[model samples]
Target: MSLDSVAENILNHLWMISWQICILAIVVWGLCKVFSRSSASFRYWLWCIILLRLCLPGDFFQADREGYYIPNSLPTVWETPVTIEDALPENYTGSSSPIVNEPYISLHLSFPGVIVLLWGLCALFLGSIVILRAVYAYAQIKIYPRIEDPAILNLLEECQKSLGIKKHIEVLLSPKESDGPFLTGILFPKIILPQHVIHSWKEEELAPIVLHELAHLKRRDLVVNWLQILLQIVYFFHPVVWYINRKIYTERELICDDLAVFYLGGKRKRYTKTMLRVLQESNDVFSAFGAVGLAEKHHFLKTRIIRILDSKYLGYKKMKKLTLFILTLFAVCSIGVFGQQQTTATKAEGEVVVTYSIFTVQDGKEKSLNPEIFFLSGVDVKKQQKFAPGEYTLLISQAGYHHILKKISIPDGVKKFHIQEQIQPLRREIKKTSKDGVDIDVVIDGDFPAGERIDPEIVALNGKDVRDNVFQPGTYRLKISQPGYATIEEAVTIPKDAKTFVISRTLSTNVRKVITQISYDVQDNKRPQITMEKIGTKEKILINSDTKIKPDSYLLHIYQQHYFPIVSKVHVWPDDRPYVMQFQLVSKPVRIRLDVRYDDKKNLPQQLVTLSDLEGKAVQVVHDNHRIKPGKYMLNIQHPDYTFGREKYIQIHPGDQFLILEKMAKKASSPSGKEYTKLFFK
Candidate 1:
């Protein structure tokens, strides 16, 4: 494959892998509960699991690929074209066939190719730097000053005995500028120390750092560190992987500190002091994953001290091992639970369950068939298992035989729905071929209304235009179709003797024009009710996004309370353009502030301000500053303890703002003389 193709594949892999990483991250986050109160060993294992996931690409972890139907090109089915964005400067009226068969992607390289190339270059640069740093660190180990003090060796031996460690470790003193202490290597472990601290450090002060490095070897962290660095070089683009690597190293230090403190009379203060001194002297390249350094990035120093001083941390004896075992089991199971691809083929409440099945055409006498290479519709999502209620087209085609298509309509109704179909086999016959093999002409015979034309889209077997097609002596399926008409499927049999054959078809028209008008509460200042007026009759339909309507002229209206209503005249006809109705309800808003009152309270009566339309549909406002469309509505104040003594009708106009203060509750026996504020901004 060419580099372009390889890049494209990598781009696709990254796209898939990104989503897999997201699922694994969520599972890992939940597994972190074990690290909270359990041993550091589990957290190290968890980091390993995350790093393992990073090394895997998207294709590595997936459920069995389910067999799904693939659709072919058909005339009965229509779809919006896929065009490159910004390819055209003009507004997309969707009036023309936007299929620019050539690459309209501009420039030679594809967009995905550009992204993949950029990622590859970045990975190459970062991987080279990492490898170079690892080589340099190893070279530094070779030339660094060696610590040959016998007393220091005895102190290391003593600490190792207390921790039950048996591996032989070599000690080398780093340059004065180097970081305090660190451990590196696998078969032969090396403990590197700074020269300045080695000369001035007391045996007790230096022993903790030495033992801390030894703890790593016992925990087999050096091997994990190598794995982390190698995978980091491979997946350099993933920030999550790098972050988890840091967490692993940070927690490694904390765990080793626990081991070293256990050796020194569990003296947390003395161990912390030693770490602080080491932090000040050490200056090594801490980015090397395999090198277990004494000091973390300076920001983590406060946290390290806290963890060392804290009674309960990772490696503490706060929680029982059984709990840790169960948590580890639970974490492993959680990862496994979400690791595999989710198989969710669910039907929502009140949604119809649709099942699509296919059978191949039976050959000769044996009526057996296989379900392969059939196209079904309404399967929008990739690997979608279930079908929802909607209009879909199923197209079937075979070699030498004409294509057969059926428009499948699953209407909203009961729960269970099933559709089964058998493919039709094409018949072949030996015949004489003239200068022109066969001629299939498409004709439309019907009276169409003005501004509408029946341009029959004729398709023949073998995907040839039936309007003027040449074919061998065989049975051919001819599909002659037009928008807003019933499709006719005809089979044309060309005779051997005859030089020409004509397959003439007729088209029929149905009611495909509609006009609509809609109206709702104008005073509420909410969205208007939009509906379509039915064709040949006075009916209405509430049109939502993606609603399929018959090809007809329509008048759509969406009007609120008092302003002028929106009117749209839409005509759906056969064309390369979309039938657009660019119109909206026009209205001006008026702001209204309400002050509710009771028997003796001046305002704030604790009443709901209710506004209702003529249809008695009401919307309640709990606070002030509400904008209402210019219209008439019933205004009333309501409270739990008392009812509105009277109801009022209010009319708001454009560019009007007002405050309405009215009596809120049922009047008391002697409160008839009480005054009220003006109800409108006069």
Candidate 2:
């Protein structure tokens, strides 16, 4: 195979290995979360189970090549003889057949993208849960009272003191009136109590319940619960983790139950019965101290019941041994799987060593950037030397900026080099400003000669620079009193792009604030103008010159300032001077006149409207008690519509013309009516 193909194959292999490591890491994390609180003995058993799966009796840890002595593209100095054990494949094999062991990832399809996509989905799942928790808290606060009942408040205060927790606690009663208790709190912890149980329980019975919940608070079970929730997010795709999560939550409740029973000491039996009763009366929102008898949580309670009643307690000596053994096993496995990769780099000095270094500079000053940002350049940061003598090319690029390229050759003995490059700041200039009383118009251009790509400042004509960001187009006051100018004030309209030109005149004296009208006539030029006037209603509209227009078209769209626009289509061409465009406005219909322009070099229509003699007929809409008065009025709609396969026109107003096409349809359609209708619509 070619070198490119070989390199590609190697990269694919590495990618698969990396993906497997990531999956294994995720499984490890889930296992850690699950068994962290389990008995140390149980964790050792779990580790043994996992190790057995990884190193089944006949599995090969090293690749085998018995007789091959082929040279590799990657530098190799010596060829070592391979024995039968060393000649085994990396995968598991049976006595009669060979099978590839792919426990962490499937090998059927080489879909490297799936690894990143799955990881992204995992992150998104965790992120969504976090966001949902915040939203749920907000929604709860919006609906529930900030303060709890005085009776519950006093209980919490006493419990808080007993628990030695520094944070204040709030209690809320569930107004939903449901059975079963649910403890939910984190920052600014709150206990939601069901009204039913609190009313039913006597003062003496409440003490044990309060003690149980206070135990949860003392141990910071709420935070642990959040951690558990986060772990579930990481293992969202694993069904086993989900099952284990449900089990762990149940176990947490049981652990809390046991602690509560111990706190009661001599009255453990009575408290357990009361706990069961509390679970029964859990209709009230379960405060942290209370248990709601939710059917779903009953299975967990049953397990807790069994564990508390059972008399199987290990002595300290055995417990200590179990703990030490589990911890040691975990440390060894973690170091072996993950840490070994680091130590494997320390081989004899025949291998080529690659190093990478990033040089960052901001405003001519060196700045520290995160090493992760350098990963865009292909480099294994952990395995490769960070800074070493070598020939290397560096490229730096950020959003909305040109890329920088630099090449440097380091001598054999040199360890590191720091390079610097100055990046120019963007310059923004205010081209023009026009103000008409309350409203102001400012023009800005992003393009400047400076190396930067953003505008710095655009001062208003009369007003101070409102803000740095771009402003909406309109009219504005022009006032400028610089040191050299007497008084610079001009009305300016900011154009979209090109030159940053303003038309402000200087005044005699320099002053801070002065109101003056400024015209943004940066350059003098004559151009065709289109205007519309409503006949009797008296509404005048101006058409923008920079609009995208189609040629040989009769349709022109006119927009009113701060109002819905009007669409005009040409209905008829009368042999007259006005050359009016008639259109109907769907809402508050307004009549407008347009000066149609054709190519000056081409043959002009026999009777066409010109810019020199452009007169518009005014449109009028008489409104009487929400009903429009019917009247004979002149309207202008531009552009003809091509509806059928060929061009067609719809009437714009009451007195428009129509075309008769009797045989045209007959020629285009088949004998059947269905085909004729299909052709009509199509």
Candidate 3:
């Protein structure tokens, strides 16, 4: 692709966020279907066409062309090179700056993005299928049983008028009816009044039943119902959002019912009675495909009926302009919570502010040497409350090395800068040695000199000239080659304490055949051994072990790589068999001595407490509840609400008891208590 095309493609990809698009698609399909007529199916089709058009490969397709709809909204990611000193808080007492200059790239396309795409596609597909099925079913019903009752038809007309909603309501009678009344027009708005139901209902009973269903229809509750289905399709991955949506749907139904009751006035009592009778008799008419007979719909109807029957009715009062303004302000403030921005300081030099940091390179690994790595602009660069010229200093250094000081002069107009200091080589002379019968002296060189660059081919030992050293008993290799000079090859061996000389034989152009041999003393190998001791009863046990390992520090695994790590400190002894000594752990201990110390000079209380089990139930004291004896004893501790604490454990005798402190952060709180309860006890 051309660079421009590639750039455009990248920009477009960056602009697209599947989750936001899915939300837009849902909003469009829902609001349009709710407001428009089924006869205007083309309009619904048009909405889909517009969405597909945006996703298609095209030119000059601005993201904002559709206004708020389909505009991929995203959070911002900060990207700036900053010095280490900039990252530190103003009151930081540490010698190094805390500023981190590394740019932060927010990954917009996360798991939710993929999930949202799947959700939107599923919603669109299912919604289309449902719409087609409902419309086709409505068409077939229109040919079967048309609205015949003039009074019922007039009531429907009056209901629509009274509700101030203008829409065509297809009233149909089905021979396939088993029992009861139902309202079925969610996608293809229709009232499927069963022939059996109409025959059984009296004139007075019919009006309320029809009105209850009409109330749903007039409010476009069908559209909302369909939208709910669409949202479920997208957010099926999150069960919580589904639960929230379900509650919202139930609340929505209740609100509609309240409106219907208010409009009917005194007729609400009769309406409610008719609702209960219909619910009881027409239980078989509950169609899963319809809008009015959902599981929560019936439950909501009962609640509404009970609420209206038991309570003194109060009409909803319309808010005045002043009240509306105040309410709007509160709403805006609520939404503002989601619009919060993270403020970071930056160095401003003239119109352009610059913030930068320094990085160090060693053995091909780049490490940021600057301690303070963050810089902010216009805020508190120095926390002086007054704007200062954005200028910063950074120093980079490593152990056993000289420091590289950088004067970060922010150019008058530069906004950001990145400073890098190439590390200079700290060459050490490898002296010749002769011991146990070998002798050799070799000089190894090649650390990138100041202002000098080393070719990666030589560094990687790929091709080109390489520095050579005589074969030695050490853990290093070398190559020797100089520009415009014949290559020389020599072998040298160094002994423990004896001095030896390595005489380099310069290579003539025609010379070949050089022998190289490396010799070094090998120490005896020893395998690391582990021993675990069980200190408590069968149910409770304390485990401890020791090992004399060749490596000073190694990974100590309990179970395997799966669980968290417990780093063990290895202690070596002069008379011992180079083995680990001991560690302490409490299995299921009745009482554990908490070894608490204040400091190097002060001693603190060492309290003894009984252990709890995984279920937060105190371990049963079979023998003694007061004190556990010195021998190995099994104790069970169960704490249901405090699982993460050291409530449950096993005890080991003849060894120091160490209670495992469970982190409270890992505990889950019950929903019945405070909205969010503490996961951990003291």
Top model number, TM-score: 1
Taking the tens digit of each residue's C-alpha lDDT, what string does model 3 give over 174-262?
Answer: 66655234566555567767676666777777766666677677656666566656555544454544544554455455455556666
Tell me which of candidates 1 and 3 scores higher on lDDT: 1
lDDT of 1 by residue, 179-281 (tens): 5477888887888876676778898888888878888888888888887887777667778777788877776777777777776777889988987876666
In order, what is each prediction's RMSD in angstroms?
Answer: 26.3, 30.8, 26.8
Tens digit of lDDT per residue, candidate 2, span 1-682? 1123223333343443444445554665578687665643344334333332223221111111111111232211111211112222235251110111111111232344455456557779777868776676556643453333466667667666655766765555555555344445655555555566566766556656666666667656666555556655644554544554455455455555655565555465666676677556543332222122222355555555566565663211234675678666765665466434422432222323334333344676645443321211233334454444444433333322233322333333222322322222212333233342222223221111101112223455435664333344455565543331234456666554423233323123211221112121111122223344432234444544332211111344444232235555422221212233333222232232223332232211221111111123443221111122223323322111111133232222211222221111112222466654453323
Model 1 error, position 524 (Å)? 99
- What are the runs in model 2 whose C-alpha is more than 4 Å off? 1-110, 118-126, 146-154, 282-296, 313-337, 341-404, 407-682
TM-score of every candidate: 0.42, 0.38, 0.34
Total colliding residue pairs, candidate 2:
53
Local distance difference test values of all predictions, in order = 0.58, 0.39, 0.41
RMSD of 1: 26.3
Question: Could you tell me the TM-score of candidate 1?
Answer: 0.42
Per-residue lDDT, model 3, residue 46, is 29
